[model samples]
Target chain A: MVTMRDVAREAGVSKATVSYVVSGSSLISEKTAAKVRAAMEKLGYSVNHTARALSTAKTNAIGVVTSFRNNGACFDLSAGAYLYGIAAAARRHGYDTMLLTGDDGVEAIRSAALSRRVDGVVVLDVLIGDARVGALKESGIPAVMLGSPADSQGVDVVDSNFEAAAVSLVERLYDHGHRSILFIGWPEAVYERKLNYAVRFRASLMEACAMRGLRVGAVYAHDATLGASEVIPRALRDCPSATAMVIHNDAAVVGAPQAFERTGIRVPADLSVVTVMPDQLGEGMQIPFDSVGIDVDAVASHTVDRLVERIGDPEMSARVELLDQPMHVRGSVRAAHED
Target chain B: MVTMRDVAREAGVSKATVSYVVSGSSLISEKTAAKVRAAMEKLGYSVNHTARALSTAKTNAIGVVTSFRNNGACFDLSAGAYLYGIAAAARRHGYDTMLLTGDDGVEAIRSAALSRRVDGVVVLDVLIGDARVGALKESGIPAVMLGSPADSQGVDVVDSNFEAAAVSLVERLYDHGHRSILFIGWPEAVYERKLNYAVRFRASLMEACAMRGLRVGAVYAHDATLGASEVIPRALRDCPSATAMVIHNDAAVVGAPQAFERTGIRVPADLSVVTVMPDQLGEGMQIPFDSVGIDVDAVASHTVDRLVERIGDPEMSARVELLDQPMHVRGSVRAAHED
Candidate 1:
């Protein structure tokens, strides 16, 4: 196998120069860097990551605890996209991700935490009182969650402002002359579990309706996508007075418009629709729905920053960061009828 | 720090008994197992995974390398589903999954492979003559790839029979009285990168056409989802003699029928369309085209099996496995002259 010595010999440079080029520490001339790269490629030299990590005590890897198993269901596309975003951001920061799933409730988290397999962890689909957070804290493993803040001390959290985003969607509908609007959301079991964001969404929508004196028609979807078809029709049938709808689920937002079209309902003409989660609904899918847009990239980048901070300074106090969600009006929503 | 001692104390048993119960090494009474589980849960005691792995040199974590970074650039739904399947299978076998992207490349694969971070890796979206493969092999790491047999050496591979599937699709079209059929595929750069699947697909279709003494029309999709507005009209104008279309791209199949509809052409009646990829097109999409079905579950399960085998016995010779693709005749393809 080609090593640093081989590259150094091929480049006619000292072994230290080759090491400096590979480590990317200290200044090296661009000319020398190119020479080193060419020589390394020619010699088929690849880094010995195990030896490197052992020597440096830095694998440049971030453990990602995807807690879908504890949540007892598959994460929908939007959730999956959020994870992909986190992984992408970690990669940009010169870190790779290690995924932890059902092992969240057991020794899995602690083992990964203590083994120094990762510099820190980016926890996804986190529950409000996740045990892994406690385990990570006890093990002194720096951690950040992509969902609602866990109460564990010293853990950093980056999450969307679910309550604020939901309220903004409701307020946008009101501003658009919508007096009677329907709120399509995830199941009640999700909220009952105190999954902070889900509960917050429900509370914010209800509070927004009460403050505005608007007739809020709320329907809890059975599952993410399948329920959209069933619940939308029932919401329309039960409350024929509703002129607009706000969806918090991504799958439902993508599927609802098609469901409405199948039922011969023209969007914004017969009924208007809007979504709070917009990342997974691609323009190519052609749903054309308006949205309360949470910048997925922002959330991902912020989470990486927080995790990196915690990794560097594990003794820092627990911090919670909430990103703002902006509203993007598209073709699916319109002014409500004023008779 | 609840440990085996705590479980033993609570369960009124010895530490070895607790160990046996936790590891399931020896057959223990169900009543004793329940007692240990209850005691462990009550005392918040979980196994010490780090110590165990240090002694055994095994971490029940597998790495999944995917193309999440190239999301919109490629229709990665099939790839995503395959990763999900690997995760599910890993869980069933008492393992967790770690996700690694291309950004980290050799370092990530090597660290995850050798530092006992992951027991094995399932490499997806592998290019022909990949450097990562060579790196993994050099490090004596167990690995599997989701690509063709040609690209792999002494490494297990799980892939679809792209050439045979494409030929079968062409044969179906010919059987339906279509003399001229156009094959829309991924960009030529993908083929040039020696992905070879697309190249094989085209070759098979050409061979099939030659066997039937017919000339097959073909087009290269600039993107995964061929926008019918651009490609379909161009195909029609360029090959007006063509009566049928076969799409290997998933997203293109979703939109091709709509492009035909917009041009006042009926599906199967005006232009018959068949896709090589079958997921994502079956339901809830605008264009429901016929397909040469690729079994996503089979691909996922078989890859997992190979990965597990490689992890268990790293010195075993690598093998390639290909799953069968069946044809699903939907409304998109029909007897061509019937229109």
Candidate 2:
């Protein structure tokens, strides 16, 4: 029931100053803005967002499209981290986030675009041949992607350098004198769905090992049902000469220490181990390990920054940015002994 | 820039008919609505949500507030499942979800209410004496909570029956002829924060055990750093005669089988184990266990349904609803041996 005029009168400011503050204009000074905000708070003046948006042609909100479906089937833990990042960054920029979490991703994106409820969009869980890419482009809405899709010609994308992560993992082990190493990968379904990160990591890891002339041993999709104790021994049996291991699965890494205890393989004594996962997951483990952590927050921050920049400057060029991953050493590796 | 008039002309219908379809009013028949939609699609007519909202005072969107903060410190995985459920249910009701993931819970709700960017709100990860509850009441917004706060009067709340779950766990273990039991609870931080579910479950479990005259042994807060293997062994040492275990920690449960293997304690042979967790988690494990599964989606659906109903009918009475949890039998329990 309260109006901006009442707030301006209460604060001893002009109506235009109150308007500038409500519209989030940069023209207002911090002191003046604070005064106006305090006045608005005292007067309990709730903004009519619809009317303000109609005049300014801005919603002060962004759409975040993810693949957390209706059937409760697909939930990517790592993607959720990125989502958390965007929301926080958006809040910092004085914007809200509108989320689209249905399974019909393309349709959802199109509908969000058509309605113009948000100023921009952030896409997550991008696939190799993602249909949402075309829909986003067709909508002509400013957008950013968390995953680097197969063909991202005119879209802004920010992701962890999975290739660099793979190279770093292999080189860390190779430098430790590990020639024959066992590799543990994500589940088969991850590759089948063509999730960009999973596909990129596996391919780049194989290539990196090949380039160094390191013999890569058996690779198995981590089955959560079968804990690491069951899979690690099987992988070792396939590569009896393996003196180290590299893991890319989050669930499997949780049981790696137990697996080592059961197999009588001492860490850094008989075999070295390294895992590539989110830093939170890596650090949250009871027994930490040498790991290459994907800074998911960094990627999300970059995506949001670029999108906000593009929203302000419509003519800005699209870019693909990949951040370097940090490797934490916990003394899980040692120099191998020659027989 | 195609207008409703243009679409109506193409579809051979009145402008009012097209307006009804765009407003999502139930006055129009499905056949006529389909025709109008097809015409609008062919003409590339995108709705201007702000203008329409200004006219109708309806945004057709709901707000979801969660504590997935910017620092990347607090992400509750179980709460994420409930969020997924709300998004799906909102879409089914022809609504979109706006996410507020900032840590400033009270301010976020107040701002969201003042902005009027969403028609309703869904609050997740509620605490015992949540400040957001007061903010919601002050804003006079139609909102629902996923957790039952200590003072949830005049607000709609949907949650899993943690008390019933506790009773069921104790009775099942008691029926198996187990006289002594070891309980592994959530971290001390959970109780310190007074998360309603954790506090309620612990109290209910203790009471249920006392009622049946069961000797509950050493209760340890699950330490993820030490793992279940270390904690379980230590818990057993305190209660050497314990013949059963009840685990309420997600991270600790992941290492239970390995813990049993290390201590040479066979499940259902020397000890029986029961877990209280999300159904998805219990079902996702390669080796499933007997558990009390919280149907997160059912709770979310009910929350959304109640919120949407209240949004339509402002005078609807506030109610607290608790859905029964499903008990899964996976043969993890056995008859106790008598000396």
Least lDDT summed over 10 consecutive residues: which range in candidate 2 chain B? B68-77
Model 1, span A1-339: residue lDDT tens = 466788899999998899899889989999999999999888767765545665576767787776553232323445545667777888788786766655444465676665566778887767777776777678777788777744745577788888788787888788888888888877666665666677677788889888999898888776443446567888888998999988776556655754574466778898878787744345434446787776777888899988887778767788888787777777777788886
lDDT tens readout by residue for model 1, B34-86: 99989988986766555555456676778887643443355344544565567
Spell out the clash pairs found in candidate 2.
Answer: A225-B286, A286-B225
For every candidate, the chain B TM-score is 0.88, 0.89
Output the number of the TM-score-best candidate.
Answer: 2
Candidate 2, residues B54-132: lDDT per residue as tens digits? 8778888998888633112223445556667888899889888888778788887887788777898998878888888
TM-score, per-candidate, Cα-based? 0.75, 0.91
Kindly report which residue stretches of model 2 are placed more than 4 angstroms away from their true locations once superposed: A5-18, A21-42, A68-75, A222-229, A261-265, B1-17, B21-39, B68-75, B218-226
Which candidate number maximizes lDDT? 2
> What TM value does model 2 have?
0.91
